[model samples]
Target: MTVQTWTFVIVGLTFALYILIAIWAKAASTKDFYVAGGGVSPLANGMATAADWMSAASFISMAGLISFMGYDGAVYLMGWTGGYVLLALLLAPYLRKFGKFTVPDFIGDRYYSNIARTVAVICAIIVSFTYVAGQMRGVGVVFARFLEVPVETGVYIGMIMVLFYATLGGMKGITYTQVAQYCILIFAFMVPAFFISFQLTGNMLPQLGFGGKVADGTYLLDKLDGLHRELGFAAYTEGSKSMIDVFAITLALMVGTAGLPHVIVRFFTVKKVSDARKSAGWALLFIAILYTTAPAIATFARTNLIQTVSEQPYASVPEWFSNWEETGLIVFEDKNDDGVIQYVGNQEKNELTIDRDIMVLANPEIANLPGWIIALVAAGGLAAALSTAAGLLLVISASISHDLIKKQIKPDISEKGELLWARIGSVLAVVVAGYFGINPPGFVAAVVALAFGLAAASFFPAIILGIFDKRMNKEGAVAGMVVGILLMLFYMMKFKLGLFGGGTKEEWWFGISPEGFGSIAMLINFIISFGISRFYPAPPEDVQEMVESIRYPRGAGAATHH
Candidate 1:
């Protein structure tokens, strides 16, 4: 069968499986909608969390980032995974012990103020919506390429799928469907990697293949290092960033991962504090599978891409090259009128811009793999993007309906009415996100970094202080969020938007890129929170007792009051 035909068959089967699972596990109540009735097994929750966490960024854009950034990409790998360690060790068990349905619930009760919860809801909406916009864009890209449809149409298709499961089954249905997505996405990711590894290094595992010798009997790392130097770029394995910048970016990602409300809420689905811990470990294990493979895929794809295009005439480049070129992802400037493509860095001060988002989707083609593999990869990318978009939309909906509308504005609202508002919130969230995806304000990867920074700055300190420090009050949480978010905005606009008469690296107030500025913002938030918290009288005595209650697993059953 042709590549298109096979892709339709495989992808169709996967979609059918998702619908069946959603139908089988449809949620029946608000509890079911919010926490999957808190009956999900640790293993199942781990799988669902893996799907929720990976997103389009992991499945589609990561390898591409590594392909060009080289060692700098390691920061993402280390930062994102290491954040999970923090979550498992310090946050997950305690949050689960607190036994609330959402992150805002914990903050609201722990601080003894509904206003604090309102701030959390606002922050969660911002973070989730920013992140989901990228996923929606990713869905559009995948559909346009593989399904042979316009990008907008692809996003609409994704929206319908998400609405079907997320609205009907709620968390219950979404969790089960996510498990299926995890399976399909992982298999699709690893199989092509294995084949490419064998073809390049005679190794079945891509990780070892990355470090192994290539066809010329030279280490791949050494070859890449040489190429980078020859092309006026930094060495492939060494970083050009200052130690402070590196530390800042890593810290931001760690705190940001711990702060993400969507990730935190997943622990609530597990039955016990211990189960939450186990689930975190399992989630990390699942994430590591993809994390480790991503760099290898980057190396393999970059090398193959250079070799394929370096000596070939631009006009005679393969059909695949032309197809991607049409998308404006891959460009060649035929400098010097040599006809042969030059893969070197710009020597004439003219740079060719290639979108990093294309690395994974274009990898199979670069390696001359069968067309079916390419199509399967496209489908897998859609699954990754859509699954994450759905999760983010749910968080956005819950923040507005559960936290804002019902909890704060109208506490007496009927449960049925609240659920209806939640669905409305979901639709609005999807529309806004779809619009942003179709017309992004900036680069996809850059927008993602901003979202992480915002989450790190505004939410991480509040959540951490709320759980660990009984003295933290509503004033502290609110002030911290306000200051942190404002600082992040100022820093981002300074460098990213050139709002302050254009930004220069040398003029950076602290030599931190906007990407790495979150750590400083988070630190400022923590310091301000602690300073003000010491002066303020402290949370109510009952709230202190709540903190104590959340510290142990024995009394967790009673932590849920409703």
Candidate 2:
């Protein structure tokens, strides 16, 4: 079959499967909608959590970023992986033991104040919306190339499909669908790696293949380094970012992972505190299958890209080049009126402009891989984006319906009314998310990193203190979240979005980029929270006792709704 036919078939089957699961596991109650009735087993939850955690950023964009950024991309790998460990070990069990529906529920109950819950809900919405925008953008990119549609049209399509499943089934549906998505995406990601690995180095393991020798007995990394030097670019193995920036970005990502409301909510779906821990372990194993392969895939994609296109004749470019060119992801300008393509590092001399987001998607075509394998990649990219988008949309809807409306505005609202409101919230959230998708702020990974910064700045400190410190009161948590999120927003807008009289890179505060500034904001939050809490009286006696109770593992029951 042709690539388009294969894409349609695979994508159609996967979509049908997801819709079937959504119908089969449709959420009937507020508890089911929110936490899948809190009866999910560890293994299923593990697969679901891994799928939810690995969004478009991981599937379509992470390897692409690593291909272009070279060694500097390690921050993302280290930060995100380390952050998951921090969340699973330090936060998940405790939160599950607390038996709350959402992060806002924990804060509200722990602090004994609706005000704290409101603040947490706002932060959750902001963070989840920012993250979901990246997922939608990923969907648009995949559809633009494989489905041969405009990016806006693609976003609309993705929004409709997600809206159908998410509003209909909620967490219950999303969880089971993600389990299937994990299998598809992981298989899709690895098949190409195996093929490319053996074709390049006579080895099936991509990890070993990248370090192995080619047919001419030249080391793969050495050849890539030689290519970089010949093209006036830095060596692929050398780092360009400063040590402090790398450290800050890594730390920000780590803590941000812990604070991400969507990922944290995954633990709540498990049966008990121990089950949450077990799912975390299972999730780490499932997640590692992809994370470990990414660097190898990055190397393979980068090497193939440079060898295939650099200084090649524009007229003789492969079918894949023209295919992507029609999508506007690959641009050839013939700047010097020469027939040759210049893909150099210097912007002025580079005649070929390639979008980084296209590297992973285009890798198979560049290497002359089979059509079916290439089409499978498109399906994988969609699975990754849709899975995460569903999870984030759930977080946004739950924040509005469960936290803002039911808990605060109308405490007397019936269960059916709350479920209706939750579905309504899902519709509104998807509309806003689609707008951001159609008009994304940046490329996939960059937009996702900014969302992580926001999460790190706002939620990490409050959640940590709420659990570890008995004296951490509502006033302090509320103040810290407000200031932290505001500071992050200011830095992100001024630097990343170029909004506040947009300054140049040279004007960065303390020489930190916007992606890494979350660490500084998080630290400030810790300080402000500590400082303000001292002025107020300690938390109520029962609140303190509850805080201490969650620290232990024994006697913890199933996750509760309210």
Q: Give me the candidate number with maximum lDDT.
A: 2
Q: Local error of candidate 2 at 269, Å? A: 0.8
State TM-scores per candidate: 0.96, 0.99
lDDT comparing candidate 2 with the true structure: 0.93
Residue-level lDDT of model 1, residues 77-191, one tens digit each, is: 8788888899889888888877788888777777778888888888888888878888888887777766667778877888787877788788888889888888888988998
Error of 2 at 199 (Å): 0.7
Q: What is the lDDT of every predicted structure here?
A: 0.83, 0.93
Q: What are the clashing pairs of model 2?
A: none
- Model 2: per-residue Cα lDDT at residue 79: 96
- Which pairs clash in model 1? none
Over 203-310, each residue of candidate 2 has an lDDT whose tens digit, in order, gives: 999989979998889999898999999998888999999899999999999999999999999998887788999999999999999999999999999999999899
